[model samples]
Target: MTTSTQIDTERTDILEMLAKHRHFLRLTVRDLTDEQAGLRTTVSELCLGGLIKHVAAVESNWAGFIVNGPEEAPDFSSMTEEQIAQWGDAFKMLPGETLAGVLAEYEQVAARTDELVRTLPDLSVSQPLPEAPWFEPGGRWTARRTLMHIMTETAQHSGHADIIRESLDGAKSMG
Candidate 1:
């Protein structure tokens, strides 16, 4: 490959890494029934379904910090038990939302990310990172760091999703 081609390949690879882990997480719970997706074990109580939901939520969040602007740090302090339960209610199955439903949302988020990466200049563009509640006051993050964080976060959740899937059934590798 030419130098430019190699760089493009690496860029695609990085983007794929961001999407692939979420894909694996989605697949992990796809075959599980409602009851199965909710099954929990030690070390963590999140079920496959909840993990997937969290993945979708977090993806949109990080995407904002990278592609758009700052993240609106989620507000949970005022949530009632019912609302909190809904956030983590893996098996409860929100109206019109199955595993497939959530995956579709994830895909949209990914599509937006692709557009952002294509249109925006390289991460070295030296723009000031957006402010978020978690960001240290005056903190600045490069576009590269933002993308890397997304990939790392997705990888960790994918592992959790795998374990949750195993507990749900005997499902193994996405391979």
Candidate 2:
């Protein structure tokens, strides 16, 4: 296959993986009662709502970084103190946050990223990683790598959500 065709194929695969991961994540939490979604187990501060929020925030960040270059810092500081505190892995879900809303927001992010990737040249062109302190310094990435990393991150956190959900109500993985 030509280089362009190869890039298109890889991008399609990455998007599919991301969609499946998001599907499982949503399914794992979808049937939880409000109280169950909010329950905290002995694991990290993450609850189901928190994991959903974290993935949403990271999707937005990764899409922006890929299209606009690495941000100097994460963009959560503009939020109120409470919002900032709940950013990423913090366990607090904002009032009125719902499973449907969380999924819609992340889906928008994914769509934008997919559009941007399709518009770009083949994935050989590199971009700097997001400037979050958690990432290794000087780690540049391709569009393929960006999508793959998002898929990986989502899959891992979705597992955490599964355990917490199961703890709350004896839920089991569908597969």
The numbered model that scores best in TM-score is: 2
Write down the TM-score for model 1.
0.73
The TM-scores, one per candidate, come to: 0.73, 0.81
Per-model lDDT: 0.66, 0.72
Per-residue lDDT of model 1, residues 103-133, tens digit only: 6777787787777666665664433455545
lDDT of 2: 0.72
Clashes of 1: 0
Model 1 score (lDDT): 0.66
Indicate which candidate wins on lDDT: 2
Prediction RMSDs, each to the true structure: 4.1, 3.2
Residue pairs whose backbone atoms clash in candidate 2: none
RMSD of 1: 4.1
lDDT (Cα, tens digit) per residue for candidate 2, span 62-124: 767666677733654266877665464345455677666666776787788667666766666
